[model samples]
Target: MLAILREITIPCFFTSYLIVLVLELLRLLGRIPGRGLAVIVMMTVGLFTHVCYVLLRATSIEGVEASMLATWLDWSLLLALALAISFFVFYLMRPDTIVSFFFLPAVLALIAFAVSVRDLPPFTRTEAVEVWRNVHAVSMAGGSAAVLVGFLAGVMYLVQSWRLKRHRAGSALRLPTLETLGRMNRRCLVISTVAVGLGLLSGVVMNLNRWGYVSWTDRGVMLSLLLLVWLLGASAVEFFYAPASRGRKAVYLTLASLGFLVLALVGVLTTPHGQAEKGAAAEPGATIESTTATTVIEETTP
Candidate 1:
């Protein structure tokens, strides 16, 4: 892990990005062939290599700084790795799809963010604090993973909706059938919610019982509440009316939820002071001490 300039990850990223770009281009040019075992094999390998890079970075528990840069890079790596795992592992049960075209750009954006945020001075903490910090890191990473799945589901819904509305006949650019995308969307939504719930709950219990006075407030919590409200409201609407197709509603809800996520992220990145440090005029709520969730940006109104 000390050797960050490894050839494996750099070449692997190039290979993976190339495959995805080439595949999408072929589809756009109306020349995409049906699924081939060899193509999947190459994709799997490339995905594997990049994922290893993500894992290596994530497991670095020696020193952690709760600054915007560190948190963003860590969460992005977790998300990229999670998505890679999901895409490859699920491909076997599911049919081939070109959904990566939509997702890859986001992946690249996060990675670019990771690279841009450099030069963080490492901190030394007491053992208890270190243990608690790991707990918070794991929880926050888990939560962010959930959010990523939710975003993907939203994109899938939009792609499916566009195709149906256009009434386009079968073509290379044609996405997964509406039914499959809907199912996948539902799966992501459900799983993501479960993870969020687990992460949030653990954070609450750990905070409320052990250290109750350290509670903090910021835009992050507000945005999370808004997202939760949106999801719950959306689900209620679906359950009540049972729309003709969940596609449109799902798309709208997903886009709005993703907006909330972006807002929260921006709020975190733009803080005027140091990272989430205790006795630093900020709340400790930025990172969960004992859960699997993405850490919210650490800041107080001040």
Candidate 2:
């Protein structure tokens, strides 16, 4: 069992999901016998392998860090796992819906991104700050997943609305009603906002504990603040504005929230947001000096 578990790799689940995706596409072409059963079976295999792979990585004793949340690669994989599970849930809830068409691609993309960044170093956290760091990571990842779902729901709502307007009710593609999609979007917005807000707060605590001061100008920090602000505004509108929460307006909010999330993710990738270099624990004096030296070097490099 240990050997089999150890053999589980990214390709294990990736291939399963890829096959499931092909199955889904095949469904669009024509009816195939046992297609739904095949999808469920493949998804189960993929999800099982995915969970095992994550567990192995998180518990491996050969690495400097045993926790899978210690690096970007692991973080991305964790995010993908969360999304894959979500897709599974959505599939079970509405077996006939095309939500998987949108979800599988996102999961694949995250896995691919994780592969590309596998060389990155793990974050270095002191024992005191590790708990808060975990909180920040989990909240951020969970919030990002919610935002992605909300964005997808918004897109589906728009497409469904367009189909209804065009009298395309006879179309082959089946989706939830606008009201259902809108409700999903609204709930996702609320969940994402709360999760990301908690993430940001935890991050602040982690930063203060590690470095004694937060760097407001850091790209990741700036982008996160911007994302949080937008989420807060969107959530306020969802609560206070009666009309905004139920129609195209609500969908637009989720779409824009996704945009902000993309920007924040870009900032994290392009800059060292949570890597060892940025997250390494240091004395307050040494941290300030290091920050100053880094700024000086950057300014003088060109």
Candidate 3:
């Protein structure tokens, strides 16, 4: 059993979520007996296996001083884990609701992306600032999760609005009402704004501590700051300036702000600095330097 768990790959959980998503779509067409039970069981199993994969990855960091997540793949998996866990809880709290239709695709996509980048060079551990870096990474992960939830809520608002406008009254429609979705969207935007703001602030401090000065021009930094500013501006407008127009306007703002966040994240993953392993304790047996985050690590023999 332990050996089987050890061999579990990213596709395992990805496939499981895919199954749940399919089940959800089927449920939307007609009520299938035991569908809710099956979805709950599958999601629970998937979440457990996903946790095991994360633990196994942590064990692989034998020599690194960093936290379990050391690369873009690691961060992506962690973010997926957060979403999976959130979905699992939601499933339990609201059974037969098919909310997974909104979230599972993104989870699967992240898992797929994580698998694609699993071999990328890791961000090496800086012993002096390991804790700070971990905090920064985790905070950003949390902020990203909030943004994702906000995006889903916004989408739900739009769909519910369309359904209502079309006068499609049916017992099969298990979506949250427009008012509920709007409130959730607004709340999630506030949460995303505050969380991303704090995460960016901590990231700046971490960079300054590691490099003696922050890399303000770095693509990732600039893009993330742009996202932060956009979110704050949207939040300000939603809450203070135009509380009356917070319904459809808030939905658009959330979606637009999430787009900026995704763009920033992609920029981070594609940048040269993102591919290099830097900092002290930088992956032993790899070429490294003291001044910049340009240390490339050649693949090692198993």
Candidate 4:
């Protein structure tokens, strides 16, 4: 089963990526055919491959069906997949743009990274604080996904501005209108802020329940706070500077948030869990606020 999955998903992902790269090169040289069908096809195939790989990983685990990889790795995969789906929906609604060429590389690279690291080690929820842990993980995953969407919007903003700035009016590319890109970028920022806020609140609850106090100083916690600050700053800039701020300027600020997201994800993945092999020992006597959360955590941990 593992062999088949690796053989198929890996090749499909790589091939699709190559096609997208070629398409990008053509668009850059002013040879754009202006249709996004090829990239869209590639993304859909890549998505299918991504799901199969994840499902195989889950099924191979002894009993924990939901979590089949290390906590960080699992979270990364979920975030990446969510971002890919977001791209698909956005492109479908507004196709025939050079925007696909720019963002598809990130999506393909994420999938390839997932395939490469599928064998590191399976992550299982420790017995202690399972409910809270799941809440933390899911919220973090959702938040990261939101950040990814914001990043995409930022990239689109740049491409649109570049075309406008260079006065390449004769180009065949059918990028989205400036109005659409600006609105999308704004929506992405707002959605990401809300998602990250939930993640932050959940992290605090999980930490207090696990260690008897909030992990206010943990590097991971600190970095997440920094990321929240970055997102909040973007919101403030957008809200108050609307008169002065342009789509391109907003894109620059949004792109800056990428660093914070990366730091936050890596910080959590590499945290010193007690049972290094299985994410250290779970903290005991943790609190659970949601019944659905409890089921998810129990189901995730073996």
Candidate 5:
């Protein structure tokens, strides 16, 4: 089983999803017999292989027992997996919709980014804080996935609203109702806020366990704090400010959240946010090892 999983490389699932995307595009041009079955088959294959790849990477070896979320490569791949699963669910729910056209691209982009950072060193974590780190990683990834869903819903809301105003409601291109999209966006915002808030709190616990103090100057920390603040503020507005709870205002809030998420991701990738030198353990007195790894940011945090 491990050998089979080892052979399931990025290209395996990537190609499957790429073919699925192409098939989806072709569906737009005209009808193809068995197209729906073909899409389901391809998506299933892609998802299976993607899950296998993630599971393989997430296994703990003798010395490298830290959670897979410690490295950018694995973290990005996990994020992509979450998005792919969401797309698969959405596709199953509305096979004729053009949502996959937008979703598959983001999945592919995340895979590409994972490939780009595949060589970076994984962060080290002690056994004591492993569970907490996993919580941090999973919550953060879930929050990110929710943000992406919200952004997509927001885009769909805008497009659907435009179509309605322009009398294109009866067009072949089908989408969810504006009200449905708004509800989805609102739900996603709430989910993202809660998940990200949990992630941030877990991160703080992990930091305090490992270093005894949190480095507020860390770029990743600052950006994450900023993101959490924005999410909280957006959620408050959507809850307290009745006018912003639905429609275009709600959509705009989600769009802005995506922007903040992008900036935070850029900071994480450009700096050693969750990563540390090879062989370093999360000991209270253990100092962080400086690395020659080239990144967009050269400054290191202790």
Candidate 6:
């Protein structure tokens, strides 16, 4: 059992989540009589395995700073873990909510992307900025999760609206009321916008302290700004415009913001940090370590 848990990988949890999603879909189609105990059991097991894998990764490091998330891969793992835990808790509370259609596939994709890019070097942070980096990373992860929730709510709103328009009593019976979906969508939007806005501000502060300037043209920065702006604008419209079809409009805007967020994530993961010290070992004279060592030696001699 120990060995199995130790060897547990992302694919292990990914497959488990896939099965859960399939089961939920089956239940929704009325092929199953009730919210089966099987779905909840499978989801619980998957969440357990997922957590084990993350803990294994977290303890893999060996040094003073080992406790901190050292790389983008670690951050990605945390993000997926957050999403999974939230989903599982929500599933337990509302057994009939059919959100796996969006979240399960997203979890799978995140796992695939993480595995594909696992070879990238981990990000090393200086002590001066490590605290702020953690805050920014966690805030952004929260924001991304909120956006996903909003996106799912939007999708539900459209489906429910369509069923009502067609007067499809059979389908509408399975869906939440439009008001419920709208309230969820609005709440998620507000949370996402606030979290992301704070994240962006923290990033700016970190950059100013470290580099004395923020790179306005950086792809990640530009896309994140675009996402924030869209979220804020959508919130304004949803609250103030008083349009009858505001629900549909809010859903579309949330989906658009999610798209921008995906782009920003790719940009951040692909681009190496400017502070990253690559190939410095080969060019010994220019390494930060060597410079510090020399300074220490000179001070000792004097």
Which candidate tops lDDT? 2
Q: Score every model by TM-score.
A: 0.43, 0.51, 0.51, 0.48, 0.53, 0.52
Please, what are the lDDT tens digits per residue for candidate 4 over residues 1-302? 66867666456655665675576567666655553566767777778886776566544544322233344455456556666666676667566455556566776666667667766664333322465567667766777776677688778777777888898734897687777877777777777776787678656644443454576777777888899888988877876686566676667777887788898777766775312444233433222324456888999998
The lDDT for every candidate, in the order shown, is 0.54, 0.83, 0.77, 0.65, 0.82, 0.75
Report how far off residue 220 is in candidate 3 (Å). 0.8
lDDT of model number 3: 0.77
Model 3 is weakest, by summed lDDT over 10 consecutive residues, at 283-292
Q: What is the lDDT of residue 89 in candidate 1?
A: 48
* RMSD, every candidate, angstroms: 14.7, 13.2, 13.4, 14.7, 13.5, 13.1
Per-residue alpha-carbon lDDT of candidate 2 for residues 1-302, written as tens digits (9 for 90 to 100): 89978988899999999999999999778889999999999999999998888777755634222233467787788789878988987798689898888999999999999999999776654543687788999999999999999999999999998999999956788899988998899999989987998799778767765655678899998999999999999988876688734578889999999999999999878876755564333456456657878999999997
Candidate 2 ranges beyond 4 A from true positions: 1-125, 242-245, 278-302
lDDT of 4: 0.65
lDDT of 5 by residue, 1-302 (tens): 77767889899999999999999999768999998899899999999999888767655333323433467887788789878888887788677788888899999999999999989877666543576678889999999999999999999999999999999988888999988999999999989998998799778767754555678898988998999999999988886687734578889999999999998888777777767646454443343322223231465543
The parts of candidate 4 lying over 4 Å away from their true place are: 1-131, 273-302
Cα deviation at 299, candidate 2, in Å, is: 42
Candidate 3 C-alpha lDDT tens digits along 88-191: 87777677566788789889989989989988877655542465566778878888888899899999888888888888735586788878899999888877
How far does residue 37 in candidate 5 sit from its true spot (Å)? Answer: 58
Candidate ordering by lDDT (highest first): 2, 5, 3, 6, 4, 1
- Candidate 1 local lDDT, residue 46: 67
